[model samples]
Target: LDPNRLPRTIDGLINALTGELDDETLLIIDDAHLIDEQPELRALIERFIMAQPPRLHLILAGWHEPDSPLIATARLRGEALLIETADLLFTSDEAAQLWQQAGKTLPVDFDELMSFSAGWPLALRIALDATNWRSALGLREQKSKPALDDYLEREVFARLPTPLQRCLQRSAGLRWITPDLCAAIDPTFNSSELIAELRRRRLFVEPFGEHGVRFQPLIAAWLSRRAAADPEWVHLHRKAAVYFQQHGDHESALYHQIAAGDPAAVTTFLPLARTLLAERRAEAVLDWMRRLALTGDETPELIEIQAAALHQLNRLEAALATYRRAERAFAASGDRLGQSRCLRGQAAIYLDTVQPAPATDLLRRALKLLPRQCGAERIELLLMQAENWAN
Candidate 1:
């Protein structure tokens, strides 16, 4: 039975089970780890097991023990059968059979192949298919990086379709991808299609419920290298940045946009920095501000953002310096609003450093700089002056 296309609903599961069964049938659910997170499916499976005739037996095989509610329910009624993958490893005779199947004469070191493959069925199968076991053993012993890359490249990447290859490239840039972002990247893509394509190609894409997907660390690293030289590297980064930004993941968005080297990322990150500061995520605000300060192009707005972040982080000396720089830039640009903000940020720095006297003086000067009818500006300055006096 194909576990991949298993019936999702309780009635569907029951009908499928009844139609597939004969007298005293043994129903095995392999890779039980895959269904552990699906509580509904697990409940349906449990219901089927409970409703089954006495002649039916259920066997579950998985790397990890199943943690489903069904497992607990079945255990309460003493109905669950569990077998671990470790129990399926080859014995001495089975190892000999595998070696023989690979068309190799049994040497004293024959069992080393099993040890090298860690007796994993898939790994053992792949090793056996590698031209000759003896030669492959020799290469494996030498620890040749090129040989390993070539083996994995041919065995893995060479089998993927072009679109999947692109998907993998994007996935490499991310720790995880949401379904919405994946759909954005590949217009025709869906979760099931992505899973099927990756599984069919034997690529290491791991599905996490309905919203997330991941790739093996090694595969992701390799795909990252493969994508480094692609002409669309910048485009992919920008696309990922946009997707992440749309999802309100500003940190991830900033990372991709920084990789793309887009100066406009500074503008994108400023509001994010403010939000982070508001959330009291000071460390993250500091990080984004530092990146924006270092990587972003020079502008009065960018400098003001850097100054604001520095102020929030209690880097009073740095904030003061940044405010001075922004003040000069604003003066040169004749931007009175920018100049007023720089002055206010400088005053805040002074207040942060226990210099409330100077801070009050700075706020009074800033208040005079604005027009009398600027009610919002006057109210803000009044509040800041009151805070300074309270300090």
Candidate 2:
């Protein structure tokens, strides 16, 4: 039943449509959010929805959560169907399918666009519609960005309360936001009431996991664009870094520190990289080192971390080149330990690439440079030779 086309009563509409429905008919009401404008019509639907024929499914579709008494009653009776934006959003795999169905070559930035859109339905639809998919892979590159932003303002962001609006703008730089995380960034987040209000309104945030909530990516992206222009954005990232550090999520902590753009961000990453590498998160260690060292001050140890990460990701050519760079830097700096580590990184790539003779030679050099105790690297090299000969 719709606002304009209802049969004067909910019962009348049901009786009129009953003869037309099948045993498994599904009825979807689009723009169900519009029901809020006609309170009597919403009440009529709420009163009769619970007893809708068992075989006839009723689906209400809306961008914002429609305020209907039926929602609560439906939930209390276990007859409700709640389809969230995340549920409706297109997945990356689905996006790939759309690409093939459209008969277009996959864009080089396919993964990047998938992440940037966070699988929002509208964004995916827009990307899929592009005549030049490669050029439109970036959200900003899409000519319809203005249309998307305007739609967001009308259907999403404009519906949020004032306090939540401010919270979103201030905390946009954060990837994941919870009440506690916002409290860490914004001193004025007096209570979780702001969160409660958003929940009550059924806007931007999604109650995720057992005790967690996440911002809808499209809404969060708009907030981030606003946040990036604010002077407090740098301060926000710094606060997030500290919070992540306290929680022992060191990888995220280091990323925020880098985003903070403090001159000493480099100093923080170097030591953190050692811990990360020890934890076998070589990719993160390498990324942190490379990003922090981009302005200047490329350390031998950082280059070694890069080599280790590339090796872990199986980019043998790049890893081998980085290992050689590290070896030269270490030799110039007279660091025997650094030289030995570089040799090991090179040897691993050589073995993986089937250059067994070079792998054996690097292992010999590493063992000779390493002290007699040699430890794990020595044991690793001996094992590599054993495996090589066995093959």
Say which candidate scores most in lDDT: 2
lDDT of each: 0.67, 0.72
lDDT of 2 at 4: 56
Q: Per-residue lDDT of 278-374 in model 1, one digit per residue for the tens?
A: 7777677667766555542367877777777777777888889888899889989988777887888898778767689888777987887777788
How far in Å is the alpha carbon of 121 misplaced in model 2?
3.9
* Candidate 2 wrongly placed segments (more than 4 Å): 1-63, 66-71, 74-119, 131-147, 199-209, 271-297, 353-356, 372-378, 381-391
Name every residue pair that clashes in candidate 1.
Answer: none
Q: Lowest summed-lDDT stretch of 10 residues in model 1? A: 137-146
lDDT of 1 at 145: 40
What lDDT tens digits, residue by residue, belong to model 2 across residues 1-391?
A: 4665453566666765676666688788887776666676577667557557656788878756667666876777887767666687678889889879888777788897777677766677777787553344333434444456677667666765567667667767877667777788877885377666666555556786554466665555666656666888888888898898898777777778877787766666767767776778877765666666562127887788777777777778888888899999999999998898899888878777777888888888888898877688778778988866655
